[model samples]
Target chain A: MNVLEIQGLTKKFGNFVAVDNMTLNVKEGEIFGFLGSNGAGKSTTINMISSLLQPSAGEIRILGKDSRKHSRHAKTNLGIVPQDLAIYDDMTAYENVAFFAGLYGLRGKLLKERTEEALEFVGLGDRAKSRPSTFSGGMKRRLNIACAIAHKPSLIIMDEPTVGIDPQSRNYILESVKKLNESGCTVIYTSHYMEEVEEICSRVAIVDHGKIIADGTKEQLKAIITDVKDLSIELKPGSAYSLQSIGKIPGVRAVNEKEGRLSIQSDAAVDNLNRILKSLMDGGAEVKALQEEEPNLETVFLTLTGRSLRDQ
Target chain B: MNVIQIAFKEMLLSFRNRRTLFFMLAFPLVLMLVLGTALANAFSTTAAMDTVRVLVQDQSSGAAQQGFAGFRAEMEKSGFAFTDFKPGMDGAAEVEKNNYDDYAVVTNSGIKLYGSDRNAVASNMTQGMLSAYADRYNAAAAIGAADPAKAATAFQPAPSGGYVKELSLDLDRMPGSMDYYAVALTVMIALWGAMSAANLVNSEIRQGTAARLVAAPVRKGEIFAGKVLGNLAVNMLCVLVVITFSKVVYHAYWGDNLPLVLLVLLSVVVLSTSLGLALSYLLKSSASGGLISLAVQLASFFGGAYFPLGVVEKNSLLGIAASLSPIRWANMALNNMIYLGDSTQVIQTIGLNAGLAALLLAASAYMMSKREGL
Candidate 1:
């Protein structure tokens, strides 16, 4: 069964459309990666799905319940870790989690048990009594996640949970996301880091200009751009070179030169590498190094959107 | 249950914020101490006038002279300097020549007091003393007519250090300086709760925590109600602490009607909280705190929190402004209850305050509902 489904979703702010005709589905227990450039409507869509924002058009179904008509039912099973640090700095970590947990209807021994378990889950059990203001950045991020998941919701939506943090904390969060999914919790993970998405997400969707441009498994997405390969050839400093004939190479898609480096894109790198090199050598270019690039998620995004994801 | 939890959490957060806690609790206490002492000194200085000089001219002979002599002795005992005018001297002319505060003309009918308007306090005190003396004498004469033995024992000229014979009408006692200021500062500081409420509401929104609560299963109404309840609890605690501290430390009288005083104070808390809530909805989070502070300061100034309303009431515009202040009504009602044992004004002010609070809350709720993407 699908844990979350959004169809024909749209959000508009004044005359500007933040999310346009967005639609997707997340199967239970799958780590669904939601990728987008900055201001690409990813947060807007997540906000709508989590009931923090009202969609201008269309519907959202959470665990087979219409979100608008049955918000409580939908919200009861959903947890959202917002992009911003939403934990209270004045409250102890335990108090913060317990407060949010209580809001989800937990009480008595169960409430205490869940609160402790959530703190333990985030590796903050020993520091539960410490306020977030005294915590390190990584610890605060962990506490933020603890507050959202203390109720043990069926689906957890994390928006850029690792945007700005140390490498260790980022890795810990990535591992935690994997563990959450393994424990039968469907996760919607949004991040600007394409590598993080590629590592943990079982399936991914790339949203740009408020529309999903690509959706599939990592390998499936890579396969779409697999026909193209980037060949980088570095020439000696001040070596003269021309691409008048190189552009005519069979299977070569595009050519760009910067400084003493020439980059060649071709449909068949292996088939066209030999000829392209010979043409470059014949053009009086002293080649210092030659390398062929393999296809990855970043390349896939670049191929589909004609721009680097990081640039946006 | 959710509202309680939310309120509890908000209260916890507020307590943990040391700066806000200091402003809420300690600031008012310190202001009460400083202002209460200063205003008390000013009032006592005014009340402690050495003597009021009066020029007395006897315009009647025979029995009236005896009456004037009796009245003159009583005035002398009560800290009045009397200068008897000779037959040809004009009493009013003598008062002006000697720069006396006032003069009196004793006739067969009654005594007439004349004084400048600048020294109204001294003038009023002199008038009251003369009236009390005349009333006592008239009562004594009536008793002498009815029973000679009783009049001789009960209605002799009052001894030098004793009060005059009792009059039929009771006099209203004015509140002392400390008592007046205690009530004024209490009302002023209680209204600061409105700013506290505004800060509490705006902080959550500014910090982005409000959006997190919104995403929870709780309804928006529950969230607003929880915040208001939490703010009210904290503010009421601060106000009670200030009130109790003033009563115990400064020996300020809150009046005999303890229950009624508490009820009216609670109404003030509600009004303040509602004002804060309404301001939170009307202004930006960053701007609301300063605006609330400014509003409370202005209200206190016009409401007679710092000085007597008489200082401003002489000006028509200021008088109207003072009358419109909630703090003015609260101060007057509390003063009446404490000094006069009157509850009529107390009940009216409470009703007005409660009604205004309800209106503000309604407006706040409507504004909250109308807000988009909150």
Candidate 2:
């Protein structure tokens, strides 16, 4: 069953639209990955879901209740870890957790036990008394996560939790997130890194221009460009070859060259490879190397959007 | 157990943070001590041998009229400005027209000086300078009548008449002492406490804890309430520190109304909390907001903070205008603490102070609640 659902969500700043007609759902206890480019409305949509921003025009239903009218109840079971580390610099990690616990109505022994559990989960029990500002970027990030989970929310939304941190912190965060998902807590994670999304997200949503362009399981999104695959060719230097003949080959679309590297596209990707390789050798094409890539999220991304997700 | 507990935590955070400590207690004390002491000394120093400005409309512009010339020179010698004007014009009118006081001279015989009775210091100084002039004139007449030659020497204008007022009071009661300044120092000290508390709210926004808090089931109002409690705790801590400091350092008499002073100080804390909360919201950068709020506090000093209103330029509008100052009221309440034997006066002062503090708190709260955390 869906624990959260958004319908026709829209947000705008002045005349510029930041999120438009965004809609998606999160299954109960599912690690939902929200994917988009830097300005693709992922955060904006998530903000609306987390009740941080009021949607310009849309409906957000959480636990089968209207979010705006029932925000008091909806927010009760929700916890958030923002992209920026928000721990108090003057407060010890334990104190930080303790403070947040107080807000969640946890007190006395209950608060202490929760704080300890969160600290242990984040692997910072020894350093719980240390100030977050004194900790390294990774340690601070971990503490940041610890504060959110200390509340023990049913729905935990993490927005770009691993930005600008050490690799170890990033790994720790990812592992912790997986652990969180394994429990009964519902997780909503947003990131632009395709590999990370492919690795952990049970479901993925690609959003752009304030709208969700596509959303499905990894296999479902990948199957869209199943017939199209990437082909790499490394030929001798200065060998510029225009294969009008290769373009006419069955199932072949076009051939392009870049720095003596040739990439070929075809509908019958696997079957057309043998015919293309044989023709290239027949034409005396000095092929130094040849490789084929099965269609993945990156190819599906290119096929769906007509632009690489990481375009500089 | 709820938001108030979080506020206590916030208050603790303020003390734990060194920057907040300086802003909460040390900052206001330093301001009151340095600025208060300097301004108070200025007042007492100026309050000493009164400076009076008298206008003289002398119709007889001849050597015979030169009789008043001795008076003018004597006035100048004694540190008064005895200004001369045309005979037809009124002396007091001329001074009043200049816009900071009242002055005039008498046209009648027997060398009478008609002084304008308007401001306190001016009124007191004018009467003294005129009497001295009259005495000298009488001596000159006596010498001129009996033995004109010797009388010239005897004509020392009545020795600057009656410079002292006839009053029965101890010398200790004069300028009200360091305790007078200390009461106000304590109340305003809460602003620093407020500043410390305000940072807790601001830190949440800065550290992203605010968003985390928002994501929880907690309402904004509860968060704000909790924050206020935190500041109040810090304020109380500083208040205790201040009371101890006063008792230990100055043996400061806050008044017989200890509870009243505390109540008024609480109101002051609330007001300052609202101000800091509002300020933290208006400015995206807490550092900048903190600075601007401190700058605005300069208004308190100008509003009769250092000493009594009469100490400044009693002749000027601003001097009299100081009577309406909130700091003046706060100080007056505490100053009146010295005379707590008179319950009526003490209650009145406390009531007025508490009322003003409430008004400030309301205004600050209304303004602060409008602030968006983002």
Candidate 3:
């Protein structure tokens, strides 16, 4: 069963549309990647799904119940780790987790047990008595996650949870996300780092200008740009390459040369590299080094949106 | 249950903040001590004296005039000045206009003294002196009618010591400076609760915790009420400490009705906290804190919180300003209960505070519902 579903979700701030005509669904136990740059309506969509914002026109279903009609039920089933660090600095790590968990009606021994479990899950069990004011940025971010998950919601939304952290902490968070998904909690993770999304997300959706431009598995998303291959050839100093000659070659779709290096996009089905290299040598270009590039999410995003995923 | 949790968390945060503790508790106690000691003379009713100016309208002749001549001569030595009332002059009006401290009408039937309410201490002192003289006069007349020999002997030698007993008509017992400031600073500190309350929701928003809160299963109303309850509890605790400390340390008189005084103070705290919540919604920014602080300071200044306005003329500019402050309404109620033994203003003051609090809560709720951002 799908743990979350959104149908034609629309959100507007006066004349500006923050999220427009968006529809999505996350099946049970799937790690969904919600990819977008800053101000790409990613946060707005997450906010709407989390019920922090009311949609202008759309329906959001959490755990198969209409989110608006069954707000408490929907909220009870969902957890959101906001982009900003929301934990209180004045409160100890344990109190911060327990307090937020208690808001969901957790009580007494069960609340304490769950709060401890959450702290342990975030690797802050030993530091539970310490306040966040004395915590490092990575520890605070982990605590932010711990606060959200202590209630044991069915689905969790983690938005840029590892934005600015060391590689060790980032890996730990990524591993935690995987562990959480393994434990039957569906996750929707958003980040500007394509590699993070590429590493763990089973399904992906790329949002731009308040709409999803693409959605699928990493392999499937890469398949969209798989019809062409990207070629990069490094030339010796004083070497020259002719863009017009390379364009004339069969299966060579596009060609560009910059600073003694030639970049060519050609049909993957054709044997065009030899002809392209011959055209480059004919233009007095001495090839120093050459490489055949494979398409990744970055290339896929650039191909689909005509811009990099990091572009605002 | 969520409300209780939120309230407890709020209380924990408030207590952990040492700065807030100092402002709410220590600041008011120090203010009370400083003002109480500095303005001690201003609050004393018996020690501060002005000459009693009496306007006499003699409507009788013979023995009445003879008695007045003797009374005036004796009173002149002890801070009494007499003026004869002309035929067309209004003795009572002269006293009302403060042209004379007390106006006397001596007639064939009896003598009547009129005093203004503006200067109760002096008026009561004058009234006590005249009452004594009338008592002696009546005794002398009765004795002359019954036994002329005894009357002649009494008239030959007038009594000297303990003739006039001073009594306070302003209050059951007039409050000194310490007593006045004890009540004033307690209520003033209660009003400062508004400063803390103004940050209750805005801080949540600024810190981004509001998003997490809004996402929780609890209703927004519960969160708001829980936070307000916590803030009210802290403020009430601070106010009680001030009250008890002043009463025990400075020996301030809070009168016999302690519970009623507490009720008035609780209402003020509720009003101030609700005002802060309303202001937070209205301003929706960090600037709201500064605005609330400024507003509380102004109210404290104009409400006789720093000094007693007992001697201020009712129609003066200062009195008008004092009357406009909500703190003044509370002070008046407390003063009435403490000094005049009246609880009528207690009901009105609580009614006013509760009514304003309800309106503010309503406005805050409306604004919160309409607010687009957290």
TM of each candidate vs. truth = 0.79, 0.71, 0.79
- Which portions of model 3 show Cα errors greater than 4 Å? A227-290, B46-161, B165-172, B311-317, B372-374
Superposition-based RMSD of candidate 2 using all C-alpha atoms, in angstroms = 10.8
Please list all clashing residue pairs in model 3, or write none if there are none: none
Q: After superposition, how far is residue A287 of candidate 1 from its true place, in Å?
A: 7.8
Candidate 1, residue B236: the lDDT equals 75
lDDT of 2 by residue, B1-374 (tens): 56776676776676787876775567656665665456666535235555566665555444336766766776677667766665577555565665324454444364445544455667667677667666666666667789867765665434445557757554434444456556766766654444554565666777777777777777777776777777777787787787777667656656566776776667666656665665555554667465745643664665555544546676577765665454555566556555544445446655664565466556545654554333
Each model's DockQ score:
0.53, 0.47, 0.56
Cα deviation of A14, candidate 2, in Å: 4.6
**Alpha-carbon shift of residue A267 in model 3 (angstroms):** 9.0
Of 1 and 3, which scores higher on lDDT? 3
Candidate 2 per-residue lDDT over residues A79-109, each given as its tens digit: 7888988778888999988887777778889
Residue-level lDDT of model 3, residues A99-137, one tens digit each, is: 999989899999999999999999999999999999888
lDDT of 2: 0.71
Best by lDDT: 3
Candidate 1 per-residue lDDT, tens place, A1-312, comes to 999998999999999999999889989989999888888899899989888789999889999989999999998899989888888888889999999889899999999999999999889999999999899888888988999888999999999899789999999899888888888899999887888988999999988889998898988888888668988899998776678688898887667787878877777545988788788778777889999877778778777876667667
Candidate number achieving the greatest DockQ relative to the actual structure: 3
**lDDT (Cα, 0-100) at B12 in candidate 3:** 92
Off by over 4 Å in 2: A12-16, A232-289, B27-177, B192-201, B279-291, B294-297, B304-309, B312-317, B320-325, B339-374
In candidate 1, what fraction of native interface contacts survive? 0.61
